[model samples]
Target: MYILQTVVVKQVLTEKMKRQLLLSYEEQKSQLQREYEQLRFEQKKAEKKYKNSKKESAQLYEKEMQKRLDKIQNIEFQVNQLSLLPLGSELKEQELQTMTEVNVGDRWSDIENEKTIIIKDGIIIDIR
Candidate 1:
């Protein structure tokens, strides 16, 4: 009878040890799952921050490029205005008269004859 009692006690102790070991394993697994979820949340936040920064950078670049284009356009407009003015030291009043007075309805042949006469006289004449 004593031997039987000892066997039952040993079996009970073995079963208790198995239950404790299973509970410890489950706790470890639960802790690891929580850590994994936290890491995923942190990664998502970081990605969002990076995307926002990239968008802001692109907008700034666009604004800077537009400013440069506007500056160039203004400079080009000023250059064009400067080009329309007359050049050289001679003014309009200083120009020599090179044409003889001709009335309206003058024939082309008459203009040609006048040009020949002026050429022979060694004087340059311009007829329109």
Candidate 2:
């Protein structure tokens, strides 16, 4: 009885830890997405300002706009990379699984990204 109780307690703790891990990953991903959105907004603002600028100011604003573009691109890349995690994934990896049994609607998520593999007739048909 004591052993069974301990086992149940251990399983509960394990599940709780898994939930925490999932939450942490979600938080990180959310942060990245928020940053990406903010960067995009800033870029838009910069573009508008650039458009309204005079010749010399336009050249300066153009430089600033280019820098903003690079920053936005970097943030987008970060967000894309963080999109995969314990919460959900849709990325397709190079590793092949030995187990072949799967239904048409069965979905397997990537460990690193928001990519999911679509299985059709016991084979992986697409990754989305």
Candidate 3:
């Protein structure tokens, strides 16, 4: 029989990877800022269209804008934290599901422990 199991993928952080991650975070923050601006514009437009219920429209749009602001702040915090980590540190990149063949005598304990794949410099370095 075959069953699906989760596997963890970890990346060994190098200088290059660190820079790339920082760049990615910056890009995300910038995108969120753009969305926030767009939201503000929309809120203003809504207020003009619904003068009688401007307060309600403003409140709704403010809520959505706050969400984007929070996301931008989170990305900034992550960037700060990532900067402090030392090189060669293992970071959990992602998780993937794989099919595993099982027999009647398969050891449950071993199967229960998910496998980890370690990558360094874009190459697979180890599997544990």
- lDDT (C-alpha, whole model) for all candidates: 0.41, 0.46, 0.94
For residues 2-73, write the lDDT of model 3, one tens digit per residue.
999999999999999998999999899999999999999999888888899998888899999999999998
What are the runs in model 3 whose C-alpha is more than 4 Å off? none
Give a tens-digit lDDT track for model 1, residues 57-79.
55554565555456555545544
How much does candidate 3 score in TM-score?
A: 0.92
- For candidate 3, the per-residue lDDT at 53 reads 96
- Residue lDDT tens for model 2, 1-128: 01111001011123344455457656765665566566566656766777654465546545665665666566556555554444323333234333333445544332223334554333555554
Candidate 3 global CA lDDT score: 0.94
Off by over 4 Å in 1: 1-13, 52-128
How many steric overlaps are in each model, in order?
0, 8, 0
What lDDT, from 0 to 1, does candidate 2 have?
0.46
Colliding pairs, model 3: none
Candidate with top TM-score is 3
Tell me the deviation in Å of residue 37 in model 1: 0.5
> Of the candidates numbered 2 and 3, which has the greater TM-score value?
3
What TM-score would every model get versus the actual structure? 0.30, 0.32, 0.92
Candidate 3: lDDT of 84? 92
Pairwise TM-score winner, candidates 1 and 2:
2
